[model samples]
Target: MKRCAALCAGVGMLAVLAGCSGTPEETPVASSPSTIGTTSAPAPAASVPPAGPLGSAAYQAELTKLEQSLAGPLRTLTRVRTAEGLTEAMTTLADSLDAASSQLADLTVTRRLTAVHEVLQDSLGSAAETLSNSDRTEANARCGGVAYTSQKVQRQLRADLSGATVPLDRLGLKFGGTLPDPGPEPKPVRPSNGAIVIRSGPTGTGRLKITNGTANDVAVSIVTDGKPPAKPHVMMYIQAGKAATISRIGGAYHIYFKSGADWSPTRRQFGEDCSFQKFEQAFGRNESWQVNLEPTLGGNAKTTEVEAY
Candidate 1:
């Protein structure tokens, strides 16, 4: 009986060991292919192109309109003939430019057109500044200078907007108007024969005896020797082959003479066949001097040709 029990126990132990050693089914796991020797490529980045002219039309129209508005003021400004008129006209032009600049600020333009728009804006400002900064005294002296400045500003603006992309006009751009003609040539003032056209300064015991041996009429100017030199202290005219005396001349002075046909008082110069010369030596008060208009060999006084004073 003990032997059978021992054999049953051994059989049970063998069966348990066999069950523990038996293979069991497992759940399948998801996986990709081996990545050790593989690489992933990223997608390409997107690109955007520059805008074309389709977006530029509206901005161009606005700019063209703005440019046209300046023509009236420019016309008025350029038509002015006097300094006072120029001052008034320049103020008007500057105001117009200011208004244009304000309008420009409200505009919306494309990237390429933005550069052109900024150039226009800058030109307007520059023109306004130029008008504002003009020297009033100089303007009064030379109205032509004012016209020149205006013309220069207009030319620069035109040149700056000359690009193909610029909106010159729906038709064409007009910046300023026609400049007025510098009036008719001033009529020459011809003094009578042997006339003293001008005489100034304190009178003294000095005197001058002038002899004209040439065929043409001669005018002699006693120019004062001082600051702002060449100002005439006494001016006298002598007919051909005539003699004249200038008495009561005062202070130190130089002798200048011009032989010509027509004498212009405003220009202080002769109109035709003008020849200007000045004696090298200076003469003082209370001295009597003699001058010969005819050129002489071995002359005591030296003379040189000088510019029209």
Candidate 2:
């Protein structure tokens, strides 16, 4: 009995050992041959289409609409105020671009749509660039016009103020001169025939003389280089043969010959005589001077001469 029990215990131990030693059933680990050396499929790549022409028919239509909207306000601004009109036009353009951007933002990403997407992007970009450039140009032009007009008006006002002259009647009262008989009828002032002589001095001084050869008193105006004479430096006036000296008023050297007057010596008077003296002084002694004679209706004389001084 003891031997049999010992043998039985040994047998139990052997069975446990065999159970532990048996190959694990591998849990039937189902391995796939496909997974052995295969890689996972790659995620789809984003597609980019090639850009197309910027001025396609569709793009041209949109461009036309934008241009027309801009043109009206631009034209109006050109004729009147520019700032407000330009601003309004720019706002409209921005709104249009915003709408376009919204449309572009909603585009669905797809490989097949890549080409269309690229074309749209290029067209939008080109349009935006063009509009921006146009806006800058228009704004600059408007600002320049405003500045130019402001300067012109200011200059004209200053000139009118500086050239203001006291009426002859007021001056007579100050001088205690009896009012000349209310003249029955003064003859119409007429321009006299004369030759304009321009001379240059060694010291860089320019001299102008007008000699009257005709009999009728003439009203005459002298223009230099097609520009009206400036006051206080260059001056224009009629003179009789009496040795009267006419002077430079502003930028003009002028002497008017009375119908019966011969040549006269005129003193140079600036400021009071001419308003544009500062501009005229730019022509130095060695420079050329242009003289234009304008008569009431029918006579016009134009001549140019360089100073010999």
Tens-digit lDDT track of model 2 for 178-294: 111222322333223232233222222343333322233322333343342322233334443311222332332332211222122231211111111111222223222332222
Kindly report which residue stretches of model 1 are placed more than 4 angstroms away from their true locations once superposed: 1-189, 227-230
Model 2 deviation from native, Cα RMSD in Å: 46.7
lDDT top scorer: 1
Candidate 1 yields a Cα-based lDDT of 0.55
The segments of candidate 2 whose C-alpha lies over 4 angstroms from its true place after superposition are 1-83, 109-112, 129-135, 143-309
Clashes of each: 0, 44
RMSD in angstroms, all models?
44.8, 46.7
- Best prediction by TM-score: 1
Note the Cα lDDT for every prediction shown. 0.55, 0.28
lDDT of 1 by residue, 77-158 (tens): 6576655666777777666666665555445444544444555566555656656666542332232234443444445334
